[model samples]
Target chain A: MPGETFKEYVDSFSYGSRTDLFFKWLKGAAEADAEDYIQSLLQELGEVSDTGDLSKFFEMTYEAQLAANSPPGEDPRWKYEDAPFTPLSKPLSEMRVGLITSSGHYVEGEPHAPPELSDYTQEEGTKHIGEYGRAKPFLSAVPIDLPQEKLGVHQPGYDIRAAQKDRNTVMPIDRMKEMADQGVIGEFASMAYSFIGLTSQMRLTREDAPQWAERVKDEGWEAAVLVPV
Target chain B: MSVGHISRAFETAGTPTVIIQSNVYRGRVVVMKPARVVYTKHLMGRPMSAPFDTERQTHVLREALKMLETATEPETSVILPDAYRIAPK
Candidate 1:
């Protein structure tokens, strides 16, 4: 009974903001079909009743599982060969984190980015004040990540690096690796993480998400530092 | 994991994972376990909550390995196990 009651107030992510997501997942929870899988998610959130903060709920759930020695119910692998994967188990402080953002184009569910869309810096998506000033600090994107004072000049030049003549020449993946080699991390994760910058369409987000995830998998990284700008 | 099929692929691969909406505290990363998948409404290319009414799109993620503990899980979990992709236009 108590367990059921606790379930009543367990909030996950957006709290009441995205209750639709939970319901969507619930519609197909049983089948695990794209539909069933979605419904199961809805059922999970619907349980978060009027009792508490969803974010705290997140912390509490992890704390409880850790205390009880419970499993998060994931599939396990018996045959890992190359290198033993080290879980992301740092004190949360000393992690080699990364960031990404847009606030410009490439919206899904609506219309994708135009053939020639500029980055947030060039676009008039926000006023002279810049949305980054408010939420920018929270994200971990490339150029925009510079300190608050560097606002206009904070462009990450990711496009230039990525568009260079050679694949290895583009981007700062090597810089990340160099940091890793220098004992800059308890354990340097293999995968680098990212997010959609400015697009507002859920559909566009859905399309962009898997690629970032794949990067994490490809790099064999132990953990992800998702910022969602 | 497969490009679109993140949930199934990760769980089957046995990779331990965690998913959070915001970075939360600076450097205070939250690690969850036994997760076949760890979805987040969080977007890609960027790593923080986006603009207003963006749908957050109700994102979901999958995981392969558990959090290396034999502990009991919580009555309230942050993520619902199921997540969906947008229908084709």
Candidate 2:
């Protein structure tokens, strides 16, 4: 920590404190250099330039930058050629159900997804995946069926304190079980799938999603509930 | 938006799907058109509501599940009646 610059110390301060300091510094710093300073500062704060709106980048937290850059007034970055057309074949109480999520829930002691497959950049995983697109083969599924004590949250952005205390907040393995027990759904798929949901690697998704669909079908699940974190 | 894409993928392949999501992804979900989007006002990670709040969580899930039978249109969205109260940090 020795000889760190004043700005480095400022970066170490909490976001609110840093924002206050940033305004103070902005008032004294050269107006012409403001944009450059912001861009560099954001880069220093672990934001990858390829993601989000560079124009208003300084205003976003590391967590929200990805959405900020979603092509002006259009939908999210990627769009499919086909419209959604699938319809349920049965009632909720008669269909088999399963859960899938992008929250990065994993068994407590198991190996995390290799960075090549599911990037884990601590913040802005979508950004990392975008930059790392198809650099390696992407594996589609991370199974979840452990006890609450054996579950962990690997997704970043947003507070996971509640989830850390109880995995059901996101994964809801126990809740799914309850739904099956109560006849809300006829049955829970014996296994559920979890993935690092923040990725932008469409290539990987295009490759893996149909496979996941097949897996769900193979498991006898008539429906899948997608929980987005 | 990967969630939206995955939903589309599953539905495209003939498996019905429902998305339990926050309003944060509403625009994209609307555009991409998942089978059903059960929108909730919960915090990003707590889509089923706060941890260990079993009754509320179960209620949210039931509502989302029910959409499978009721959502007849593409990109159908059913908003949850309750919200995830953000506890003071």
Candidate 3:
């Protein structure tokens, strides 16, 4: 009866399940009451739900949430009339390749910390959302050889637990190194660049991205693989 | 997406880039129009592959890197045949 009551209470929310409510909470939606109710229900049930199911729920609801929250009559997605083309001038085996990831990864003791939204209550999160996009875009250079144990991720946009377990899930630094050693590609760039994926696209396009491009060029990287999470 | 914008910036600056993106954003990726893209059916947080699936991860990386040499023009995109599903225990 308790389990049935808990399930019924969870299904009462607009999103129709506790998992959806959990994702709404994760995304900083103003759902404090729902969050509290879900937590209490979990406590009452005394059962730990499968995280894979939670992740699946988040993926299913993510686009709908974005569509619902977007301002009317405006397409928030980016579009370009033409894509820039820069052909590889040299053989793959002879070029220095680098990696750039929107994984929000940083080595332990690094100066950067991606935005932390999970600690905020719903009211505080609502206030934080306004300023979230304004946060300056930054790139952290992670060394190619850094141990996996030292890697950390802080992107607020998605569930970061997989990346926490194995950063190669996002960055693939180990895979890159293996390729470089095997000559599947040229030398690996000394550093792999990373940034938080949930920042203002306008600032990134107009300002920070160009600078980062310059940094990539200046570093003599001929090609790059961008892994977006 | 930030990766799309950054890839454009990099390519504009004479550095070619290949984007390994999740297929869920294929529509968006087409509009954003980076130099090259390889769409995989992996989950959002694990673009390369599922965690600890080293062989698949390496394969994804290698395939994306190959596009750097093989792509002739901008907006060259491919959807990888690979898919990720959790194995039943």
Candidate 4:
């Protein structure tokens, strides 16, 4: 049983899988005004790929993470427009609230928070999310009036379709686009919130939620809400 | 589908389950188990194009769950067609 080699580790994911399009803007992918920045990334690393040090992987992980954590607001990696800036015409009691959480998958040796709130303090995760319970009211209201299938579209990234682990994931995104294109939105953006994986301080989410919030705003949704979990 | 209906189905079938809908983002297969289930693999990236192909995602999830064969209920596949659970988990 030879241990996994550095080359083997790198081979696990394709550039598309490993690369963060939002975090790293390449000139090609999503329209003009975009360019690949891999050259500088390589030059900074001395363009050495075969480094056998596993620690380099950790360093790279952290470096990529840091770049993601504190990115510019104007140039966000999250792929969503701001939620429309309309304060909920209906009060919190009247409007439906959506809760987005951060604890989903916690693989072996992967990062995860301890159960207790105090553990978050010890873990220093509270830095990004001040209080987890602030979002309770919203979480409490889920699976509300909206049709289960229609509401399913809101939790786009969550395992909406995994009802039996035997079929597909939620309302198809392509389907959603078609629905939206077909005037699915009676008067508002049909999809309210896009709950991209909620690793609060993580890069992907930092880009995901803010864009969702903005999308909620831009879409003129009453409130594409989220509650800390 | 209500989480209750999902849970009841599993209960009646007599399996320990985490019945998540791929569209149920909070409990989506990708979000719940991103490592096992690839994101993009979901229906042409209907959700997001982050992971692999849908067939590949299903394959990986099924395989990963297979590892828990000895474990009770044999971790089930939560992702499925966009339909309602007769009951909620």
Candidate 5:
């Protein structure tokens, strides 16, 4: 095994063998040095060169490497749900519209909730991924007409320079108004909605999203647009 | 992931929603079948393209709004004409 990289050893095995070995490594690493485990795991990603092989490896290890507590045998595939449909009741120029985004937006001087970070711990022969804090939802919506100076964004990772320069890139509330003035949509709803996109907890989202939806429906908006970061 | 759920929430609440996303999400959106999707070949964060380029941003917005009007079936999508080319700093 001298001078052989992780990927080299991984590639020597058949598909089932590789998967079994990957889980063994993942679980053992979690029980040993979690930080070094993640670091070494990421290093192997750079050694694989083929897109198809890389993608397969990623799919195989997604939860084991990331959310180590994900229940085994559960498929993480994005399940398609037949969402309820509503046709445009009128022409675009005559519909009242609202905006929603997962770009971590909130009004200035207002409190915003942060996403729950994973708390990983190793028990005897197992990893215990605790249900940490709840993902903070900006439960209140904002007026679409709010001035750019009065708004704030807390999303990290992606470069925010462009968005800070022009909030239209993420929130687009001002652009929504301009569209209203131009009759592309009849009017902008009095308010728009935002949520931080970093969380993995679906329970909190399931609770918060419907609250906002009730408000949007109450506001009588005929259509809305979801802009994701 | 959250986008599709929220879109479904809006649609279920009787307000049809059009999702504006980057081309990176084409497969996911096609699978989830939001009421309508308008994708831009722009980068991830700047869905409407560059800042202050109101013309291009507006073009993207108009295209998204147009799909809301003209898409005849569920899972329909339109790709805006803009392509993202990252410039060296």
Candidate 6:
């Protein structure tokens, strides 16, 4: 197909369909020559379009991407047949709650500063996604009293653009305080916890999380709200 | 996924935790199994809603907090009705 024809063909599909097609093309191009892959993809697209049944095609494309992106050797995701539960021993109005976010936020002078604040260029941010499973996991304790102006997010796993404009998008410290003031909850914990969500899951679950639990217990927080980016 | 694991660890350590997450990973959340989960249709990074949307942000937070008192069993999940909107660039 000619370039204009191809563009017209893609434009005919719905927004969701076009996105699925784009990802399919992206995955194919990664393994084959760009020009050759486009020709084959166009032929397949034409076939699928004619059938008016793209569900199977979309499913296969999703599965292919999942398999291609999954880490080598055994599923990396954690699974537990029995999830542990601990009911609140006190009323909501009497319990102290804490905030935990995987938004990779930290104060400007904190020890766990993200690369973006140091030397990583905007282009480098895109490259940082590959560091997901390898990055060292660490936690930052953000004082609830700290000014929002000092807060900065370093999460590369997802778009941090919204967060950069307003930290409350991920960490609703101010809103939590308002709730506390209104007696929705007894009090907001003095410190809010945070860490980069794109780091090694194994290290986070086994090493860092247990310690964080102990810290929460030690600090006398009754419950916590976990916000993931 | 990290949040799910951390919430499990917290519950195991005897500190109750409730997760406020994006619905995009609902399947993953189900498998990882946190004690209580409240999902919002907000975009991945802006889980509480768009930037500076205090009214919507508080509403989401309040819903998650309510799960602490209301969740009676493990793996209890709630899906909020809020729809995801594209964040301004």
Write down the lDDT of every candidate, Cα atoms only.
0.28, 0.64, 0.73, 0.28, 0.63, 0.73
Q: How should the candidates be ordered by TM-score, best one leading? A: 3, 6, 2, 5, 1, 4
List runs of model 4 lying over 4 Å from the truth: A1-133, A137-229, B1-52, B72-89
Place model 5 in a CAPRI quality band: acceptable
Lowest-sum lDDT 10-residue window in model 3 chain B: B80-89
Native A-B interface contacts kept, per candidate: 0.08, 0.64, 0.79, 0.00, 0.50, 0.78
Better of 1 and 5 by DockQ: 5
lDDT of 6 at A196: 81
Candidate 3 has a TM-score of 0.76
Candidate 3: tens digits of C-alpha lDDT, residues B8-81: 99999999999998776666677787899998876556677767888888778878888888999889989887
Name the top lDDT candidate. Answer: 6
- Computed on C-alpha atoms, the DockQ of candidate 5 is 0.34
Q: What ranges in model 5 sit over 4 Å off?
A: A1-77, A81-83, A114-136, B85-89
Q: What are the models' TM-scores?
A: 0.28, 0.70, 0.76, 0.23, 0.68, 0.75
Per-residue accuracy of model 2 over B10-71 as CA lDDT, tens digit each:
88788888888876456566777577888776644567766677777777777888788887
Candidate 2: where is the Cα deviation over 4 Å? Answer: A1-72, A80-82, A115-145, B86-89
Q: Write the per-residue lDDT of candidate 4 for residues A1-229, one digit (tens) a residue.
A: 1595433333332222333222321212222111222334454456345553333432343334333333343323222222111222333323322222221222223223323332442123323233432221111112222443333221211222232121123222232233234442222234432221322334333243344444444444432212111
lDDT tens string, model 3, A43-118?
5444326332443333333333333233233344686788799998989999999999998787777744434543
Q: What is the DockQ of each candidate?
A: 0.08, 0.44, 0.57, 0.02, 0.34, 0.47
List where candidate 3 sits over 4 angstroms from the true fold.
A1-77, A114-129, B86-89
Model 6, position A167, has a per-residue lDDT of: 79
lDDT of 6 by residue, B1-89 (tens): 89988898999988888998877567667778789998886654677887777778888888988888898999898988766543433
Candidate 3 docking band? medium
Cα lDDT tens digits for candidate 1, A130-158: 33322321112333222222222122211
What lDDT does candidate 3 reach at residue A96?
Answer: 95
Q: lDDT ranking from best to worst? A: 6, 3, 2, 5, 1, 4
Each candidate's B-chain TM-score, in sequence, is 0.25, 0.86, 0.92, 0.29, 0.85, 0.91
Candidate 1 stretches greater than 4 Å from native: A1-115, A119-123, A127-186, A204-206, B1-16, B19-89
